[model samples]
Target: MSFFSEFREFAVKGNVVDLAVGVIIGGAFGKIVDSLVGDVIMPVIGKIVGGLDFSDYFIPLAGQTATTLAEAKKAGAVLAYGSFLSVLLNFIILAFVIFLMIKQINRLKRETPAPAPSAPPPTPEDVVLLREIRDALKR
Candidate 1:
């Protein structure tokens, strides 16, 4: 077969198509999770932690205008460990969501019906007839 035929076959497979769709959706889902982390959760956390903005928190290795952590990075200063903390929080949320998904999937798998037990083998017809004949002889 030609390369185009092989490509067509590859593209048409159900699993491959499903994977492509899943990747697209997963990218969108990642953005949503990022937004949730950045917008909703972070602000609440900042308030709880004494009005601290994570994105603004960074350490400047070298700079004059770096009056605070935020100013350093905004002024293009390097060595920002504080930003790492914000990313770490995002990772934690993502992990929790994945864990919950796996747990639900596992629960569904457990609830599905198992294979039925096999029936026992039947007794042979010849054995039954012989038993009846022996009983008649005795009678």
Candidate 2:
């Protein structure tokens, strides 16, 4: 077939479509996790850690003062590893949640063992009697 037709067939496959959907959902979930870390969780963590600001925790190679991440970006400063640490915290949380979900699924999978096959039905009474009678006659 033609190149375009081949490409169209490949793209229309269920696996490719599923992958595309998964990527989209994963991207959205990543944004949500990022927001959770940046907005909610980190603030509490910051409060617990003696009011530590994760965004402001960066070290400037050129010793510039931007105060916050936004300011740093606006001022065109050299960002250090602190942004990485923030995202790392989110990644850790997300990984931990995924691990917990997987663990629970595994536990559920282990709960019910597969049953063994049932025994065959017993022989009929008349059939057993006839067999015995035949055997006696033969003897």
Candidate 3:
């Protein structure tokens, strides 16, 4: 086959197509999760923890002392542990959501009814005749 045909065949496969679709959806899902964490959940947590922005929390390693992370970075090198914490929180939330989704899928699978067993094939004529002869002898 030609190279173009081979490439087309590989690209059009069901698994490859599904994987492409999944990557697109996953990218979108990641954006949504980022928004949820950055805009919604983090703000609420920050408010609960005295309104301190986690991303602003960092240690100045070789720069002028600054109150905010951006300022600190501009001044010199800094350790951005707060940003790491925020990312860690996002990962935990995503993992929990995925776990719940998997659990629900498993529950649905368990709820589906199983197929009924098929009936066995009929007994052979010779076997039936043998049974009849045995019954006659017993009588």
Candidate 4:
């Protein structure tokens, strides 16, 4: 009825709560992925490609003769393609991991159908014969 109550109701809904939790976890996971790309994967890649840091790989757009990306940016506008590459790698890895998790979850959710109900067994031959004889006797 009141604004506060309405807001409270909306905020405490199951879907909203779940979404909030998901956002929090997603942010933390993003940090982890960023670290993985920046600290681990990028270093190895840079090493393989001749020991050049990807984050420092940028093109000077404003005619700055700076060596590092930080210096280039401090001097003038520069295209930071190296940082972009690292972030792109992070996104790819995160997407791949999420894809695998979703795939596994889907596989688990696919339930095998229960076997179809079978018909009851036929009556025994002796039972049928006995029933006929009893009916005849009664008549």
What TM-score would each prediction reach against the true structure? 0.76, 0.70, 0.81, 0.81
What lDDT does candidate 4 reach at residue 134? 100
What would the per-residue lDDT of candidate 2 be over residues 1-139, giving only the tens digit for each residue?
Answer: 9999999999999999999998998889889999999999889988998998777776655566877766666666665576788889989988987899899999999997889898989999999999999999999
Ranking by TM-score: 3, 4, 1, 2
Once fitted onto the true fold, the runs of candidate 3 whose alpha carbons sit more than 4 angstroms away are: 123-139
**Candidate 1, position 72, lDDT:** 70
Local accuracy by lDDT, each model? 0.83, 0.85, 0.91, 0.95
Which regions in candidate 4 have their CA more than 4 angstroms from the true location?
Answer: 112-139
Tens-place lDDT per residue, model 3, 1-139, is: 9999999999999999999999999889888888899899988999999998888889899856799988999989999998998888889988999899999999999999998887998999999999999999999
Q: Tens digit of lDDT per residue, candidate 1, span 1-139?
A: 9999999999999999999999999888888888998899889989999998877676566654665765676677567665687778888988999899999999999999998898978889999999999999999
lDDT of 4 by residue, 47-99 (tens): 99999999988999999999999999999999999999998999999999999
Q: Is candidate 2 or candidate 4 better by lDDT?
A: 4
Candidate 4 similarity to native, TM-score: 0.81
The 10 consecutive residues of candidate 1 with the worst lDDT sum are 58-67
Q: What CA root-mean-square deviation does each model show from the true structure? A: 3.5, 3.9, 2.7, 5.3
